[model samples]
Target: MDRISQLPDELLLRILSLLPTSKDVVDTMVLSKRWKFLWMFVPRLLYDDSHQDIDYGRFSRFVDRSLILYKAPALETLHFKLGKICGAGDLHVWIRAADKFSVRELIIEIDSSSRASPAILPRSLYTESSMLVTLKLNNAILLDVSSSVSFPSLKTLRLVSVTYPGNEFVNSLLSNCHALQDLVVDQCPDDNVTILTVKVASLKSLALHTSDDRVEDFAHGFMIDAPNLECFHLRDGTGGFCVIENDMPNIVDAYIDVSYALPRTILSCITSVQHLDLCLLTTEVFFLLQLRVVVLTIAYENISVSVRLLILQDAYPVSSIFPCLVRLKICTCETEWLNLLMRVLKDSHKLQALELGRHHNRGGNVYWSEPSSVPECVSGNLETLEWLDYEGREEEKQVASYFLRFGSCLKKVTIKPESTSYDRDKLVMIKELSFLPRSSPACQISFD
Candidate 1:
């Protein structure tokens, strides 16, 4: 063991890197005298406040001592999460020491309650433009970074609850990080915010989660110039968020959640996307379009009969919106409205899978009413049918009976009940249908 510990410093450093944090590596000092010094050579430094009752005074001294003891320039990563006990000055000192060692990745997280004003990063650390490849800052502030503060080697940046000077601050950050491929910003403060723009060419993935108040002003009207972007996610925004006009012929996946009033013209900008998830209020004006694979969720509260009629009038006809859709999922609180909606899908010959579920109400009681039978046109093209929240009631039996009669092509039918009390009549009805063979085109049913 002693001989093993005496191996070259590089080999010992690689062994210490396997430990998650510096303290964990330090604990190995009890193994032998040689192991005490082995951890000092590890290239990665991790400080997690939750793991220890850190004394700021002692911690400051320990960090300074550690830096002096391990004089070699070897650190590659410095990850620190400051809890309520640490102050900004303590963090500043450690960051400066890590910069001297040429750390490549810097991850700093401040306590959620720590509202200290943003500190200006040290001149050498921010402006040196060394091997720093990734930077992540959470619940902190970034102040006074000039438009020329470029990080040519940085590839990924994530900011959460961070306050910047203005939109130009964000624009300048993106411009400097030319090699950035992934950018994520969530819950960033917009008090002094003026403008936000994205003009990165190499960016491939972007996620924006903004405050409800700033959703329209900050997120709605923006342009993205990344042609190679493949994955894009926008959340909690209103006023029909639209993509900045770009020719991303290679774009394949996207998720957009915005207000009900967004115009259909926003979707026209994305013609090549293959996977899409959206939640919207039904509109009266139907702009004819087709999707190969789509998961659409519609939500409303206290819908009235008149509103329902309006939805039937202007909502994009199911046939035209998903003409080539192979899978369909419908989630709603109004099960009574399913009969009318299924009638529109009956003509969609390409639909192979169908899922229907009722939304679970949190605080209020869930009232289950008898659902009417499926229309004759509801089942021929579907091979699979899943009914969620089934309550094994006589009304549920009537709904199942309609599927048995019309869903001749169904290979499997699953009924997921919220409870285990199976209605004897429903079980008998299902058993009778399950005995029928596919050649005879009888529905095979299962209950869970």
Candidate 2:
């Protein structure tokens, strides 16, 4: 009568392991007598309280029952996503249970807003968990760890919005993890860390985000010495990692978002990056030598990082050759974007697609003027242009007219006007754009 349920327990447990949550696997007991206790034998368990109408009392009881009665000798994964109602005492017991099970992967996410301060994790999590492979703690607290601790199997560790005791605690914790490969530290305000130091030798990926809003907040410096890093993401509001030392010849991709200017040492680190996403540039850090897919920024003196899928975010484009670029997306809301667009278009000979982002009300100081000559990409390689939330102002019409008239190889024009624009005005704008003479007779205009 039940063909699927009649399969062997091992095969059923394998399917149960692939489930989204352990709750669903536990609920499968209603299927038949064969699955009545199958959940207890499964080596993986995940519990999240975000589901509908599940309060903390019910969530805590279910977790306690599940962990206490678990028959699995060696758990590979034990995850918990709790809300603010969960007390820190329960977490201590759960972390101890994970240690006893020798879990390989442990992820704990607590709603940090529940308490005045983040709950400090049990020290055994740092010292005793030799079987852990991946550990992620969100909205947690880390006390000062001595040099005696070690995580021999830890490879990926993420501490998001986590409060740290001090800089020494960070260095001590990282140094103990000899096998760490991926590390992320997104600090919270009032976090005691002033100087974040990362000196992992086996690390391949590192992402650091620190914010300092006031003058008193001290997230001032960074000392990184990872020679084998392949990718890193750094977002520092107060220029914390500007003067970082050493080079990463193994770096293949890098994402940097900083406010203050950085020195030459920062550029030397990511010279071999094949993909880069850089925002808010204040210094002339010269583009990467092996850049491939890039996120551009504002006010660059010279453009050098040539990559596919280029994004320009509210900045003037400097005159620079982009030989490797194929697609350009500009999201500057200002109406005075013709110069910015043309400058980039002139140099990107291989460019094919262009997307103009939503126009904003606050216009820039610069006025629109026709380019002296049509750009090479416009007449040769350009294929498609999309204007989102097209306002169809006088300057906007000039941009549309210039591109339609000169783009010889253009294939399509997609215009999505703002919903607030008057129907009559939209019709007139569409008519004007449709009537504009195009160098490519096969080009099609799409209006939405």
Candidate 3:
């Protein structure tokens, strides 16, 4: 008589719930007579191709039998990570079975290596799953769904590498999610989705990323009109035009990474953002904005802001463009980047902290120019400055000397030399920077 087998039915079921897959739960039946039927009552099912030796047909049959025999009143979660089964079956049947059980959370992940056709989702998945709170689909085809599609309780949805029917279906799908708060759409490229428009009002957070190296070009672009959204993120490598039609007053932060720079239409809507991270293919992208960002901020209250910019065009923002920008991190190697840097230092009136670094593999000799005048930040609010991958180049030394000479309120200057830099060169750089006259007597300079 095993004492563990004598545990209460509720306690034994709880123990089985911790197992990773439904197969493990079923295997527990052999441990004792009491556990023979306890797994059938578990409220969760996780089926995956974890056991490699098992043939696809046998696994498919097991799943079919298990779902039919499941006596649970409600399935709180149903997850499937499936591999190709050579005409083994369609996923629509399994999804329908889960729908009958009122599954609250459903996750389906498909193996792309399988040569079989992508899973064609059932219409019931979009129109009937009112009880679902979270739904995530990966590598699946979402066909042209009904206009009446709805998910009354869904709060979070993630679709990655999913093929959509068209913009209308995408719009219809989003509009029907009455309670959707968080959404992520990545690499969902389709011929009919040239103008990907998302107009969800109830959405609080959203992330959109176009696929890398898309074979086809997007003729129109991407459009979004989420008024109540608080956070927005976008990574588009398609080089398509992106437009935001609504004023996102509730948005507190935004992160953008694109193969091309964003046009003014997209930037203007997110000017209300307090924190921003922009990664662009070229610095000329900023100049492409129709309205200067400096002019847009005048209407808002004087606010402090932080920005991280990864630009490749060897250019920087124009003077007065970032009047309220207080903190900035820039990664660039264009020898001419300092000109833009000087303009930023001269224009950002409230600027306090700055960080500079080389984050790319671009290699070439760099040139620096001696500016005619000191930037306003050097005389007033500028405080902390850090530089990474310092190589003791002449241009780098000149810039460092300029900062050490004029930064009045500066509290610290940290330099992290590149791994390829020689110790003798680093010593020389430290000695050269030490002699420069600092406007702030308390400022400390350290090298790493």
TM-score top scorer: 3
> Per-residue CA lDDT of candidate 2, range 43-117, in tens?
789998855467778888888998888888899999887655566578778888888898999998876655466
Query: lDDT per model, in order?
Result: 0.58, 0.71, 0.71
Task: Report lDDT (Cα) of residue 349, candidate 3.
Answer: 66
- Could you tell me the TM-score of candidate 2? 0.70
**Residue 236, candidate 2: C-alpha displacement in angstroms:** 5.0
Looking at candidate 3, the ten consecutive residues that score lowest on lDDT are: 303-312
Between candidates 1 and 3, name the one with more favorable lDDT.
3
Error of model 3, residue 234, in angstroms: 1.0
Task: State the RMSD for candidate 2.
Answer: 8.1
Considering summed lDDT, which 10 consecutive residues are worst modelled in model 1? Answer: 288-297
* lDDT tens per residue, model 1, 293-403: 011112323222332232223222233333444555544343233442354355345667776664333111223443365433354467787877665555555555656
**How displaced is residue 268 in candidate 3, in Å?**
2.2
RMSD of each: 8.8, 8.1, 7.8
What's the TM-score of each model vs. the native? 0.66, 0.70, 0.74
Poorly placed runs, candidate 3 (over 4 Å): 1-19, 32-44, 50-53, 85-90, 188-191, 215-220, 283-393, 396-448
